[model samples]
Target chain A: MAFRYPDGRKFEPKRNEMTKKSVNKDARFSNRGMTLEEDINETNEYYLAHQVAVIHKKPTPLQIVNVHYPSRSAAVVTEAYFQKPSTTDYNGVYKGRHIDFEAKETKNKLSFPFKNFHDHQVEHMKRVLDQGGIAFAILRFSYTDEVFLLEATHLIRFYEERDHTRKSMKKKDIEHFGYLIPLGFHPRIDYLKIVDKLITGS
Target chain B: MAFRYPDGRKFEPKRNEMTKKSVNKDARFSNRGMTLEEDINETNEYYLAHQVAVIHKKPTPLQIVNVHYPSRSAAVVTEAYFQKPSTTDYNGVYKGRHIDFEAKETKNKLSFPFKNFHDHQVEHMKRVLDQGGIAFAILRFSYTDEVFLLEATHLIRFYEERDHTRKSMKKKDIEHFGYLIPLGFHPRIDYLKIVDKLITGS
Candidate 1:
């Protein structure tokens, strides 16, 4: 005996049951526990649709091992592993300026850990700044729900100073050097307005 | 009895034999039949390593359906499908300017088909241009081994005129409107020289 819909379509009970449970769990998490990444992605989508800026978060790189190619359909990746990203998470054009940045979320109320960024990523940001592009990091305090856009110069300075003092940057230092991004209804995290001020020096 | 290497490692005969055959076949093709995409990727790698410029081809977007998470190792993608890219293949910062472009290779000797580009990609390129960022296309003739850097403005004009004329842009038209990129050893496709000309009008 198998389960069937009202329209008489056959349904696999086990798979559907598992899927329903997963969906409910995801809904619960998304409502009150949406990640910083998810919020930034939604903001980027709004920016694109409204023709505000052309920024995008690059897709996570994967090293695929085996792919199953079925007839008359798309190939299915059977085995794959996530590769460490070689560059920053986000980059694009904003007002003809090359904008590049990484987004990091910290649960600590007092400080953000320096270990959140890799050595290569810090070096990459240095190169972007050297080439005259605008580079920064969006640091999100998960507990406070506060987001700040910290310029690459300030980030690099703090990164280099990690060997001498604290292993993390204090919230007060971030407040001193970074611009706070206001959360809005449509765009969510409006970081571009901060960029505009940085460019104009106003 | 199982086959074993001199170093006491067991060798899987069937898998190794198949892998060796495939490697040989790929080597044969890569010698004289590598793709335009490969060349551009090699050039980008060279740019990054030498600290000349930072450019990267975005990874192919995939829609993951199922994942198997093992306790000891990284999560493996059990099922996934390729998704149509919403943006161009390549984009980066070059000399303080946002650079965005698509590379297309055609075997057709007479004309490059407009069908190589999707409507969304063309629209995206137009947006890049409107924001004063540098946008262009790298058109490569596979048979002739010729590559040209055509600016986005010219490409948009020809794309709009496609309904009134032939479905493809003629080689003569490409020659007239685009700058030919001379192939070199170190940097491979030296398209940046043409970008310099575009910027300074030299």
Candidate 2:
């Protein structure tokens, strides 16, 4: 059977398109244009290869309605639809603690809207936190090209306290509460550097 | 879109059919008849609700070949095929350590054939072990009604030591190397109790 991550294969041609300019250029110049999801996935692969962590992006949840067996060779999925994920986008083992996080990239200039996340994801994060797992969010501002790691506790607080006036997390607050992800070449966004700090409670 | 897990829904009717007989029955009788996958899913749900752990079964990996956007309601999957999983069946955090494992049930009383596991899953478990995460397999002997927790190291040894003669893991060898899971009413398989022991190194 064929194997492919939903968006993973879709990004390949685009990545290949960047080959000419990205090949010889420095790390930041080559990678700054990639999506946050791709960057994190590449980073996770690097960590896995290096034995640094076992983090993985969970597959997109789908509901298969009908399957047609054309022959013994293959069973084809004829009818299915996307299902909202019951948990965050990414999770895995990190330094003996359950590492869980949702990655979101926003085009808004001043703040990130609370609408970016679903209710179940917020609840899942809370449960993970209560279970003593490390929970957080990797947020990226598309226009400014800034990525920050915001701990779930702070995100939870903002979410719980949200009102019509306080609908989203402000950029200044994100800057104050979240750690900026150091972007580099090979692994791209090194969020684990921040995770190491989180592990040590520093 | 429906949020049903592949087998999760498939088993519901069978479980409903068992409600009358299983409702008043003892835990062992009630759960012993259930599939290992269902039991583990129910156990994980219990753990999550009680804040004991945040484990989850990874969804079956499928390669989507085509999608049909019929109106704005839902995008229907027109073509897809099941793919080999790149990791174990289940993983999560337990008492501050990463827990990763595969669960299998076999009708064979003599042994569990090594062919039950895919190459990628074994490699994934090894990587998890090297990264200091907990890795193991939960094997249930169906005919004899026995369950054992075999650590990845032992399983790895059995796998690597295999020749044409040693095609499978003998039940006797498994009983010697693996720990019997203490099953219970609410959780069905209390594998974490075994995990607690592993963490303490006692």
Candidate 3:
């Protein structure tokens, strides 16, 4: 049995790869060329090894339709599909506190679009908070290489406000309310620092 | 793209069917009359819906080697294999407490072979206990329709004593130390009662 995608596996080609990167008005904020998912995963690895926290990205659920048995020792997956919208992107325990969060990156320099947040995820975060869990999001302005930890309570407020207007969250709003985390090398994103501040106000 | 397997699809013969019932010494236990994996899954669902706990069975990690895109809506998994032994069978949160456990069912009426458990799982449970998390096992004596929630500390003691003339824990020994949870319709197995006892001894 194997735990990872078998070697030589290939992903489906990007559907809109032909479209060029959007040109933004702010010339100073060139989009950083790092995948948010990869960075967060690496940081989680560092956290686990250091015995700090144990956060993990939930596997993208797949519905397996058909499998074939070639030999007694192994079987091959014949078909599968993504399951559905997930409750949250990441979840685990941190110092006995239940930790849950989602990550989103936006290319827009001036605003973080509300569309990047999903309704169900918002609802799930609300429930987590109600259950006394620490819930939040890591919003990254890809254009500026900036990452901010926004409390779910604040995000819920923005989510509720979406009904009256279609406006995205202005960059200044997050700057004022969220904890701006400086990017680092070892734990790439030192999110626990923000978590400590959120829980302890330190 | 569909996230679920296509409707009305099935796997090969050998991979589909597993023994579902055990009978020994006038005691009979149903495998939930389903797969071991499915039972744990349903139990977790029962646990979550009742707000009694939040436990999840981690997806079995697999290595995918090939996928056939028969259509845009469906991706057929062509080759995959199970990975290495897992650390634990189930994990999640319960009343702000980190919960970790493994579920195992044995057919033998006289004794459950120690080999049913992996070394990694034992180690994982120990680690969780060291970190102040609750760790245990849902051991189903399939021959007797009995399930016990045995604390990891007790199990660890038994595990280490294996070389010192204790081959496997006797059924009576487990009954004396573990909490036998009568399966119910909702929350399936109410292990939390045992947890309450563990926490307060009341």
Candidate 4:
């Protein structure tokens, strides 16, 4: 199928067609073009390889319908549909603590919109927090290339207050409540350093 | 696409055509005929609803090759292949501990085969244990209706010693090293009670 952007624009899958100049531009901009999810995945891989943490991104849920098995080949899934995820995107163990979080990126410079997340995700995060797990969101302001580790409690409060307040969270509110995550080269996004501070207060 | 069992038997999709007597047999046996994976899933669901724990089975990974999108509804995956899982089947947070485990059942009354697991899964479990997460395997003896939570460390030892020792672990060794998980109605398998004992030793 033809891949489409959120705005309904057809997304060409030929990423290799991009010019070297654009690639250099991306490098110079500290990977401003890369998605937050990609950066987090790279970070998780680095962590796993280094024996620093055991974080992993959960596989995308798919409801398989029909599968065909050939005589001497791998089975092929012929019909399937994507299912809505019931839990957070990333989870693992860090210093014996259960770490759970979702990573999200938004182009909006003034505020982070609530539409980027679902109600079930928020509820799942709340349950994680209640169970003594460290639950949060890695929020990335794509336009500015700034990332923050916002605790689940803060997000939950804003989500519950949506009935009376604006649907989006202001940048000032995020700056006040969230901890800034320093970007790096090896791990790309060092959100765990922020987690360290959250755990040790050091 | 047609479904088939691992033994090369073509699976007819008409599950509803089963006789009532067979259904009665299934019900009377307390779902003993069901796969261990299915029982664990039901147990996980029960745990989630009762706020006992928040474990979940990760969806089977699929490598999508082709998809079809109609103008109005969700996109349907037209061609895909199941990818080998890199980690264990189940994981979640329980009482502030990161719980990670794989569940396997063997009809053999003598031993559980080591070939049922992959190398990457063992490596993943090792990482979990290194990070202080609770890592184990839920071994089910289908014939005896006995389930045991064998710690990952024990499994790793047996796995690494395969060159010198037997490729499979005897049931006697498992009975000595593993903690038996009691079967129940609400949670179905009370593995956490074993976990609590493992934690507190009380």
Candidate 5:
């Protein structure tokens, strides 16, 4: 079943919320079971609390068609359609630097699928880069428990080369081109550390 | 009846074909008699194409509960609920500065109602201003066909004073403190001009 909102629109607020609920206690107990999205959200909260940065995930857009007003104070969405997002998953500012990125998780144990990313996303990243903004992606190999912060420039290169080659990028490829992000407790995923490295290296 | 995605998932692919439907006889008719949301979307496209800025309305979050899969390829949403937004409606980058604003429309001919603005949104704008980002609200008086870009600082002042003084800001105060942005043909609402003025004034 699809989700409906207070205004009668169809869009799932959070795809992993129910699963998160189920494993919430277990996660709290074992310190193991946090989804990529949840961890990123938590990390963002931590960043905000520490006055470090202000990053946010763009919500999934929905085109509401039908609305049910049960009373003067209540408006429930009865019918709505989902809309495709044009930009990246997350964006914000960090110490005066504009930051933008998309997060993706793969179950692949050996290599990440190039097909996981859309062409428009690559184009968007390119535009962000051209306009002098930091653009990158956080890739998580779910099965292997590995996380890598791949710069948008490297992703763009792989994207450009895809027309010539139809194969997925090997683990070694990302390991060489991307910075390995060590997960911590406060900001569970410390992507800014890698960002600091990138800015300093440049 | 509520609309559902093909696969009964919460997400529906964007209707790319609908964009083709927008192109009409007159270049000014690009909005194509769509809803206010569609019109704003078209305006955002124009803004992006002209390299003016990258403003986008954040999507409404929905918490879907049940979905019915009528067929292998078709999904029908059965139940869901709306979630309160934590941030402003629109945010983007412009000329190396981060710009964040909310757009609101009112039918009242006298004054833009204070109820149109939310407490959290005002708080968000205050933080944005403190962080050195340009924050404001675009108020469209639909009855008079007039639009005004009011700075967040002005809004914060009015809002803070509301506890001891008047409940709402008069139209005259808005006219004095806000920049009147005449509705245009190409961008429909040329806010960049006001932004330029704000930057220059600072």
Candidate 6:
């Protein structure tokens, strides 16, 4: 359904309320039912609270076409169409370095498909990398319950070199070139630890 | 009336067409009839083309509620509402530095009101600054056709100290603390020049 709502005034004013009801129950309940997006958002919250970093997910872009104003105070979007994002989903700063990345979850057991990433996103990552910013991808294998932080350079390489026969990035190749993000309780996807390594090149 | 569409499929898929037709008639026509948003976008485009910087204005945030899939390939949002953004509008990397800011146009020539900035955006800017990113506000005085790049620290100082009957930052005060961004031909708002000075702290 492209993740839109059905009807009603569902304008959520969540500054810190996206996961306000979903978290702080217990550490064991970490990511029990949350999607990759939700988990990363929660992780970002934790980071913000601790002053660790300031990264944010860019909102889904929409080409708004129709609006119905019921009152002077509130505006309701009656019709809008999804637009292909020109860049990655997430970006921000950490320790004076620019951070940018895209998150994708795959149910496939052996590989992550190249179809998951758009060409412009790859190009955008390359540009970010060129500007001396940190660019990467967070790949989550749902079937195996594993996650890896792969640098954008490698992702771009796999993307550009993909042919009809090799439509997907192999799991082994991913593991070879990426760092397995440690699953944690507070921040579900602790990818910044890997990012720290990338920044210092340690 | 809140900048949503009126009717039809007005999905402008303009990766490069935002100012494609409006610009390049001549250098004298530079920002002759464009809005602040359009001008900044064109400037960012110029930056990208010149490999000068990689900056982007974040899309307006909305809480989409309902979507209809007319076909397997196309999904349309039939219901949604505007959500207050928790962060600033623009953020990116330039010269290996994390850059973040909010662009605002004021009709008032005497002062730029604190009302233009939301509480969350101010907090977000503060967080960005704390993370060692360069944060500022691009203030365009539409009445006078002048623009200024005001740093976050000074903006924050004015914001935090704002009180009853003194709800604005004066133009004189802004001129003292902010850099006057030059209006250019190719890039309508040449902000990175001031940013370069900021980076060197000269």
Query: What are the per-residue Cα lDDT tens digits for candidate 2 across B99-181?
Result: 89999888888999887776788988888887778999999998977889999999988988888997899999999999999
DockQ of every model listed? 0.27, 0.30, 0.21, 0.38, 0.19, 0.37
Clashes of 1: 0
Worst 10 residues of 6 chain A by lDDT: A8-17
Candidate 3 on B1-202: residue-level lDDT in tens?
1111222122222111111222232221543554344566767777667666666665544455554665544455555444443467577677777777887777877666676676777976776676567789878888777888899998888887786465677888789889898777555667777888886851
Q: Report how far residue A163 has shifted in candidate 4, in Å.
A: 3.3
- i-RMS for every candidate (Å) is 14.6, 9.0, 10.7, 6.7, 9.5, 7.6
In model 6, what lDDT does residue B63 have?
Answer: 71
Error of 2 at B149 (Å): 0.8
The window of 10 residues in a row where model 5 chain A has the poorest summed lDDT is A4-13
TM-score, per-candidate, Cα-based: 0.84, 0.84, 0.76, 0.86, 0.82, 0.88
Q: Single out the weakest 10-residue window by summed lDDT for candidate 6 chain B.
A: B8-17
The true-versus-predicted C-alpha distance at residue A4 of model 6, in Å, is 13
Candidate 6 runs further than 4 Å off: A1-30, B3-30
All candidates in order of lDDT, best leading: 6, 4, 2, 1, 5, 3
Specify the highest-TM-score model's number: 6
Best by lDDT: 6
Q: What is the TM-score of chain A alone in each candidate?
A: 0.83, 0.83, 0.80, 0.84, 0.85, 0.86
| Candidate 5 lDDT for residue A66 | 49
Of the two candidates 3 and 5, the one with more favorable DockQ, higher being better, is 3
- Model 1 over residues B106-197: C-alpha lDDT tens digits? 89997999977878888889888877789999999988999999999999989988984679999999999999999876667878889999
lDDT of each: 0.76, 0.77, 0.68, 0.79, 0.71, 0.81
